[model samples]
Target: MARIAVIGAGMGAMAAAARLAVAGHRVTVYERSATYGGALGAFERDGFVFDTGPGLLHLPAVWRDLFLKTGKEPLERCVGLTEVDPASRHLFADGSAVTLPNASRAGIVSALESALGAGAGERWGDFLGRARDAWDRSRRPLLEEPLWDDWQVLGRDPYPALRQRRMLRTRQAATVTEVGALELADPRLAALFEGCALAYGLDPRRAPASAALLPYMEQTFGSWYVAGGMRELARAVYERCLARKVEFGFGSEVTSIVVRDGRAAGVELAGGAVAEADHVVAGADTALAAGQELWEDGDVRPQGGPDAGQLPGRFAVLLGLSGARPASAVHRSVVHSPDTGAEAAAVFGGRLAERPTVTVLRPDDPRIRPDDAHEAVTLTATVTGHGGAVDWRDKALRERCAEALIDAAGTAVEDLRARALWHEILTPAETGAVPAPSLAGLGGRYLHPANSTRLPGLHLVGGHAHPGGGLAHAGMSGALVAGLIVEGADFRGSQ
Candidate 1:
């Protein structure tokens, strides 16, 4: 059995470690923090709990498959899983609203028609057809397998071109914004689609129309929530890793991947101790790892693009309210920015938005609160991920941004400000404080670094690697890495 050393206890890294150990390889995970689950963190205060990272899971089948492969108990048994019906509620800038049913295209079309207008439903339905085309064409290549050697093929936009006579002059909708303008042809509808992309940290203005797969994936597969906060999902995976005999070294920071004789030998710890291994799997930030000299000479450097040295981060506000949640509350609600074009300019080109689109999450689960008398709410918006550009250290600035988000969420919740007993602000300083996944869309390259690098015994997992960011994408990265190490580079994918 190969002795494998995994850097970072991120979900992706641990997922790979568990599978590799079950395959009979001896594996150990090293994390800088005292806990597992890198971005999947939880916060608690006075009996109130909040998910500091992703509040919901999309395409949960990725994790479901991981559970079945690594252990006998299915994912359902590990955690209390529930489908979030009326999947989401949308509040458009135009004062119109729609409630989308979970994974029901017909229901969504009807809701849009009733709320927006007659043709609106038809228009969205038509867009879904086109979106399905993109999903079918690219899903396997983008998710199931490792990024191909010639990943440039993915850079060629897969969004189908429209044949309308007036649109004939244009070859196709090149970017997601163009898709909204040319096809959807309504400001509200465009905002709806763009809002979804922004939540994933994609710049809707330049992101490929193929990014439609974001909403399409959610609508098709359905959105799910764990019994408690999303933190429970992370805990479940961590337990599975332990049961599989995968060792975890918390508070152990890796200084560098030890390279000997031109291959990854193991890892050098912060105190200068060395743990030898036959292979080293990295699930840390790709750019940071390279800067720390984790790779030998001529080994591939992961970050090279127009978006050099920058990854988008999230701004969040967690609220602990004094009142109990009303029965009408939906699991998630997105209040679209009043001026999306201007908001996009600020996020992709300038500073943070003065009035950004905000997503509010209020799970019905009672585990998040002290008692039935109290409630928990979380608000989030995507911002430029780098901490250097804007100083998140300023308390006044964080409060202003937090207030702006709370105001934007007013349409979804009543007396949003007064009802809060207290609130916590998590700026790019906190969310971006940790090295989260970089959304890959610079210069039309959707693919991140390949799992197999120039070094023979080194592999990369996590959102920084191929298939890119998000909880589901990170999980997929781990599967691809394990498949490569066990079956060799010739390994196509997991069976």
Candidate 2:
């Protein structure tokens, strides 16, 4: 069996390590932090806990498959998986509200109709049909398979075009913004559609019409929450790795991927000790890996897209409330910005939004808090990542944003600020992690780098690699990398 040295203990890296270990390869993981999970992290104090990264997961089948393939225990047994019904409650600028059912198309349509107006349900349902077409057309090429060598083929827009009514008129909705304006035809609905893309750090106006698939995927697959917190899911994956006898080196930072004779030899740790291996898998950011001389000149590069500096970052607030968990509280709520256009411009323009859109998560799960008398609330927004445009370190600035979010929460949590016993803030500065590149336009440019690098035994996996970010996509990245390394470059995809 080949010896494999994997960098970083992120979910994707750990997932790959677990699979490779189960496949009989000797695997060792080197983590810079003392713990695993990377962004799948959590914060706790005074017995109240809050998720530091993504609060909900979509397309759980990815990790479910990971668990099934790597061990006898199913994912459901490893962690308490709960479907978050009424997946999300949206509070629009017009004082309108809607509760969308989990993965139920009909229920979502009915809710939209009841809240928005007559015929609104039909419009959304019809839009979902178009979105489904996009999803079906691009699902395999974009997610299931390793990125093609000639990835340009995947760039072609998969969104089916609407038949033009006027003679000789051939204009088509090419961007998500166009899809919203031409198809949805309501500002509130447009906000709802764009909000989904924004949640993924995508700019709807620039993102291809295929991005409609974002909402489609969520509405179809349903969003789920672990009973305790998302951290438990990571913990379970880490435990799976341990069960497979995969050795872990915590607080061990890798300085570079050692290369010899045009192939991956192993990794060089910060302390100068070298772990020689037949292959190296990088679960960290591609740019950082490259900077460490993991890939030589002309080895490989991303197809196209803006620099990492242009990507948006996440800013968050963790509130420790001094009140009983409200019985009627929904799992998640989104307060759409009053002016989405302005907010989008600020985020994509690398400026902080004066009134940013906010997503509030108040899990009813008891494990996140000390007792029945306290609630742990998490508030997050996608903002400018580079250039220090948003000073998260400024206590006054974080407080101002927190106050605004509390106001936006409205009835979601009655008198949110008044119930706060303590609060914590996490900025991109603190996270200090690279944002995943956006999948913009139909051009192949947005496609992340492939798993197989020019180096013979070096592989890339994680949010920064092919198929891109989010919990499910990162897991998919790991599967793709492991498949490529185990089944050879000719491997089509996971079974």
Question: How do all models score by TM-score?
Answer: 0.95, 0.95
Question: Lowest-lDDT window of 10 residues in candidate 1?
Answer: 433-442
- Over 1-495, each residue of candidate 2 has an lDDT whose tens digit, in order, gives 999999999988998999999989999999988999988899999999889988998999999999999999999999999999979999888889899999999999999999899989999999999989988888887888887766767678887756544567756888778877778889889888888888787777777878778899899999999978999999999999999999999999888788778788998888799999998999865553453444345333553233334667788889999988878888999999987778878887767677778999999988999999999999888877645556567778667766766667755678887898988888777775444433534665557777887778889888778888788888988888888888995799876
Candidate 2 C-alpha error for residue 105, in Å: 0.4
lDDT of 2: 0.82
**What is the model-wide C-alpha lDDT for candidate 1?**
0.82
Clashing pairs in 2: none
**What do the candidate models score in CA lDDT, each in turn?**
0.82, 0.82
